[model samples]
Target: IALNAWQDTPLYNDKERAALALCEKLTLSQNIDDDFYLVLAELFDQPSLVTLTVAINAINSWNRMVKMFKPTVEFNER
Candidate 1:
Protein backbone atom coordinates (compact mmCIF):
# COMPACT_ATOMS: atom_id res chain seq x y z
CA ILE A 1 0.00 0.00 0.00
CA ALA A 2 2.81 2.35 0.86
CA LEU A 3 4.58 1.63 -2.41
CA ASN A 4 1.36 2.10 -4.35
CA ALA A 5 0.28 5.27 -2.54
CA TRP A 6 3.47 6.83 -1.32
CA GLN A 7 2.35 10.34 -2.21
CA ASP A 8 -0.60 10.10 0.14
CA THR A 9 0.92 7.63 2.54
CA PRO A 10 3.11 8.41 5.55
CA LEU A 11 5.85 6.34 3.96
CA TYR A 12 6.88 9.26 1.77
CA ASN A 13 10.01 10.71 3.32
CA ASP A 14 11.53 14.16 2.93
CA LYS A 15 14.40 12.87 0.81
CA GLU A 16 12.04 11.16 -1.58
CA ARG A 17 9.87 14.23 -1.78
CA ALA A 18 12.93 16.35 -2.43
CA ALA A 19 14.01 14.08 -5.28
CA LEU A 20 10.55 14.10 -6.80
CA ALA A 21 10.38 17.89 -6.50
CA LEU A 22 13.72 18.22 -8.26
CA CYS A 23 12.74 15.84 -11.03
CA GLU A 24 9.41 17.60 -11.47
CA LYS A 25 11.19 20.90 -11.93
CA LEU A 26 13.66 19.48 -14.44
CA THR A 27 11.09 17.54 -16.44
CA LEU A 28 8.03 19.77 -16.30
CA SER A 29 8.93 23.33 -15.35
CA GLN A 30 12.52 23.47 -16.63
CA ASN A 31 13.06 26.00 -13.85
CA ILE A 32 13.60 25.25 -10.20
CA ASP A 33 12.37 27.29 -7.28
CA ASP A 34 14.68 28.56 -4.55
CA ASP A 35 12.94 26.27 -2.07
CA PHE A 36 13.87 23.29 -4.21
CA TYR A 37 17.54 24.20 -3.90
CA LEU A 38 17.22 24.49 -0.13
CA VAL A 39 15.69 21.01 0.01
CA LEU A 40 18.38 19.66 -2.31
CA ALA A 41 21.11 21.20 -0.19
CA GLU A 42 19.77 19.28 2.79
CA LEU A 43 20.07 16.02 0.87
CA PHE A 44 23.25 16.49 -1.21
CA ASP A 45 26.59 18.20 -1.07
CA GLN A 46 27.51 20.97 -3.55
CA PRO A 47 29.54 18.72 -5.87
CA SER A 48 27.10 15.86 -5.66
CA LEU A 49 24.19 18.17 -6.39
CA VAL A 50 25.94 19.60 -9.45
CA THR A 51 26.76 16.11 -10.70
CA LEU A 52 23.23 14.86 -10.11
CA THR A 53 21.69 17.83 -11.91
CA VAL A 54 24.06 17.42 -14.88
CA ALA A 55 23.40 13.69 -15.02
CA ILE A 56 19.68 14.21 -15.07
CA ASN A 57 19.99 16.90 -17.74
CA ALA A 58 22.16 14.60 -19.84
CA ILE A 59 19.66 11.76 -19.51
CA ASN A 60 16.78 14.07 -20.47
CA SER A 61 18.76 15.30 -23.46
CA TRP A 62 19.48 11.74 -24.57
CA ASN A 63 15.82 10.85 -24.21
CA ARG A 64 14.83 13.84 -26.31
CA MET A 65 17.34 12.84 -29.00
CA VAL A 66 16.11 9.26 -29.06
CA LYS A 67 12.50 10.42 -29.25
CA MET A 68 13.32 12.75 -32.11
CA PHE A 69 15.11 9.95 -33.95
CA LYS A 70 12.15 7.62 -33.39
CA PRO A 71 14.15 4.39 -33.56
CA THR A 72 12.43 1.02 -33.54
CA VAL A 73 12.36 -0.77 -30.23
CA GLU A 74 12.77 -4.52 -30.32
CA PHE A 75 11.58 -6.14 -27.14
CA ASN A 76 11.27 -9.87 -26.42
CA GLU A 77 8.08 -10.51 -24.50
CA ARG A 78 8.50 -13.58 -22.35
Candidate 2:
Protein backbone atom coordinates (compact mmCIF):
# COMPACT_ATOMS: atom_id res chain seq x y z
CA ILE A 1 0.00 0.00 0.00
CA ALA A 2 2.71 2.46 1.00
CA LEU A 3 4.72 1.43 -2.04
CA ASN A 4 1.76 2.10 -4.28
CA ALA A 5 1.44 5.56 -2.78
CA TRP A 6 5.14 6.26 -3.24
CA GLN A 7 4.97 5.06 -6.84
CA ASP A 8 1.84 7.19 -7.48
CA THR A 9 -0.21 4.17 -8.49
CA PRO A 10 -3.99 4.11 -8.24
CA LEU A 11 -4.26 2.12 -5.07
CA TYR A 12 -5.12 5.16 -2.98
CA ASN A 13 -8.26 7.22 -2.43
CA ASP A 14 -9.25 10.16 -4.62
CA LYS A 15 -7.82 12.82 -2.33
CA GLU A 16 -4.53 11.02 -1.90
CA ARG A 17 -4.29 10.41 -5.62
CA ALA A 18 -5.06 14.04 -6.31
CA ALA A 19 -2.40 15.21 -3.88
CA LEU A 20 0.19 12.93 -5.41
CA ALA A 21 -0.74 14.11 -8.88
CA LEU A 22 -0.37 17.71 -7.80
CA CYS A 23 3.08 17.08 -6.33
CA GLU A 24 4.30 15.22 -9.40
CA LYS A 25 2.84 17.81 -11.74
CA LEU A 26 4.39 20.66 -9.85
CA THR A 27 7.76 18.97 -9.52
CA LEU A 28 7.96 18.07 -13.21
CA SER A 29 6.43 21.16 -14.77
CA GLN A 30 6.82 23.76 -12.02
CA ASN A 31 3.52 25.26 -13.07
CA ILE A 32 0.15 25.33 -11.39
CA ASP A 33 -2.76 27.25 -12.79
CA ASP A 34 -6.25 28.00 -11.53
CA ASP A 35 -7.55 24.60 -12.61
CA PHE A 36 -5.05 22.94 -10.30
CA TYR A 37 -6.10 25.18 -7.43
CA LEU A 38 -9.71 24.26 -8.05
CA VAL A 39 -8.94 20.57 -7.85
CA LEU A 40 -6.70 21.07 -4.84
CA ALA A 41 -9.27 23.25 -3.13
CA GLU A 42 -11.61 20.27 -3.11
CA LEU A 43 -9.15 18.31 -1.02
CA PHE A 44 -7.35 20.84 1.18
CA ASP A 45 -8.25 24.08 2.83
CA GLN A 46 -6.80 27.30 1.44
CA PRO A 47 -4.21 27.65 4.19
CA SER A 48 -3.18 24.03 3.97
CA LEU A 49 -2.88 24.26 0.22
CA VAL A 50 -0.68 27.32 0.53
CA THR A 51 1.49 25.55 3.03
CA LEU A 52 1.75 22.52 0.80
CA THR A 53 2.87 24.64 -2.14
CA VAL A 54 5.42 26.48 -0.04
CA ALA A 55 6.74 23.25 1.39
CA ILE A 56 7.11 21.69 -2.02
CA ASN A 57 8.90 24.71 -3.38
CA ALA A 58 11.21 24.78 -0.40
CA ILE A 59 12.07 21.12 -0.87
CA ASN A 60 12.76 21.70 -4.54
CA SER A 61 15.03 24.60 -3.69
CA TRP A 62 16.85 22.53 -1.10
CA ASN A 63 17.35 19.70 -3.54
CA ARG A 64 18.75 22.08 -6.09
CA MET A 65 21.18 23.45 -3.55
CA VAL A 66 22.30 19.97 -2.58
CA LYS A 67 22.89 19.08 -6.20
CA MET A 68 24.82 22.26 -6.83
CA PHE A 69 26.95 21.93 -3.73
CA LYS A 70 27.51 18.19 -4.10
CA PRO A 71 27.83 17.77 -0.37
CA THR A 72 29.83 14.84 0.83
CA VAL A 73 27.78 12.25 2.65
CA GLU A 74 29.34 9.90 5.17
CA PHE A 75 27.23 7.21 6.74
CA ASN A 76 28.56 5.36 9.75
CA GLU A 77 26.99 1.98 10.28
CA ARG A 78 25.49 1.48 13.68
Candidate 3:
Protein backbone atom coordinates (compact mmCIF):
# COMPACT_ATOMS: atom_id res chain seq x y z
CA ILE A 1 0.00 0.00 0.00
CA ALA A 2 2.95 2.29 0.55
CA LEU A 3 3.76 2.34 -3.12
CA ASN A 4 0.15 3.06 -3.95
CA ALA A 5 0.06 5.85 -1.41
CA TRP A 6 3.14 7.49 -2.83
CA GLN A 7 2.95 10.82 -4.66
CA ASP A 8 4.26 9.45 -7.93
CA THR A 9 1.88 7.90 -10.41
CA PRO A 10 1.66 4.11 -10.44
CA LEU A 11 3.63 2.78 -13.36
CA TYR A 12 2.65 -0.80 -12.63
CA ASN A 13 -0.28 -2.88 -13.85
CA ASP A 14 -2.53 -5.17 -11.82
CA LYS A 15 -0.28 -8.18 -12.11
CA GLU A 16 2.74 -6.08 -11.25
CA ARG A 17 0.84 -4.36 -8.45
CA ALA A 18 -0.40 -7.71 -7.18
CA ALA A 19 3.09 -9.08 -7.26
CA LEU A 20 4.41 -6.02 -5.44
CA ALA A 21 1.67 -6.24 -2.82
CA LEU A 22 2.16 -9.96 -2.39
CA CYS A 23 5.86 -9.37 -2.04
CA GLU A 24 5.30 -7.00 0.87
CA LYS A 25 2.42 -8.75 2.64
CA LEU A 26 4.72 -11.60 3.55
CA THR A 27 1.71 -13.88 3.82
CA LEU A 28 2.86 -17.26 5.08
CA SER A 29 3.59 -18.68 1.68
CA GLN A 30 6.37 -19.11 -0.82
CA ASN A 31 9.37 -16.83 -1.17
CA ILE A 32 7.45 -14.15 -3.07
CA ASP A 33 8.46 -11.57 -0.50
CA ASP A 34 11.68 -11.12 -2.37
CA ASP A 35 11.58 -8.54 -5.16
CA PHE A 36 13.90 -10.66 -7.29
CA TYR A 37 11.67 -13.72 -6.94
CA LEU A 38 8.53 -11.66 -7.49
CA VAL A 39 10.00 -9.98 -10.54
CA LEU A 40 11.19 -13.34 -11.79
CA ALA A 41 7.71 -14.78 -11.28
CA GLU A 42 6.12 -11.85 -13.10
CA LEU A 43 8.66 -12.21 -15.87
CA PHE A 44 7.95 -15.95 -16.06
CA ASP A 45 4.21 -15.32 -16.16
CA GLN A 46 4.74 -13.65 -19.49
CA PRO A 47 3.97 -15.69 -22.61
CA SER A 48 7.62 -15.82 -23.70
CA LEU A 49 9.28 -17.20 -20.57
CA VAL A 50 11.89 -18.88 -22.74
CA THR A 51 13.31 -15.64 -24.09
CA LEU A 52 13.20 -13.84 -20.75
CA THR A 53 14.48 -16.86 -18.87
CA VAL A 54 17.48 -16.96 -21.13
CA ALA A 55 18.06 -13.27 -20.47
CA ILE A 56 17.53 -13.83 -16.78
CA ASN A 57 20.01 -16.69 -16.81
CA ALA A 58 22.54 -14.51 -18.56
CA ILE A 59 21.94 -11.71 -16.09
CA ASN A 60 22.29 -14.16 -13.19
CA SER A 61 25.60 -15.33 -14.58
CA TRP A 62 26.75 -11.75 -15.04
CA ASN A 63 25.58 -10.82 -11.55
CA ARG A 64 27.49 -13.76 -10.07
CA MET A 65 30.60 -12.77 -11.98
CA VAL A 66 30.28 -9.11 -10.95
CA LYS A 67 29.65 -10.05 -7.32
CA MET A 68 32.81 -12.18 -7.30
CA PHE A 69 34.76 -9.08 -8.32
CA LYS A 70 33.19 -5.77 -7.39
CA PRO A 71 32.64 -4.30 -10.84
CA THR A 72 33.19 -0.57 -11.09
CA VAL A 73 30.47 0.63 -13.45
CA GLU A 74 31.53 3.87 -15.11
CA PHE A 75 28.78 6.48 -15.08
CA ASN A 76 31.10 9.46 -14.98
CA GLU A 77 31.18 10.00 -18.74
CA ARG A 78 29.62 13.34 -19.38
lDDT of each: 0.77, 0.79, 0.56
How do the residues 1-78 of candidate 3 rate in per-residue lDDT, one tens digit apiece? 557553354777665555444444333334534665556566556655455445545666787799899888878776
Candidates 1 and 2: which is better by TM-score? 2
State which candidate has the highest lDDT.
Answer: 2
lDDT of 2 at 77: 100
Residue 25's lDDT within candidate 3 is 38
Judging by TM-score against the true structure, name the best candidate: 2
Where in model 3 is the C-alpha error above 4 Å? 1-11, 14-47
User: Model 2, poorest ten-residue lDDT window?
Assistant: 1-10
lDDT rank, highest first? Answer: 2, 1, 3
Model 2: pairs clashing at backbone N, Cα or C within 3 Å: none
Each candidate structure's TM-score, on Cα atoms with residue i matched to residue i, is 0.69, 0.71, 0.39
Higher-lDDT candidate of 1 and 2: 2
Candidate 1 residue pairs that clash: none
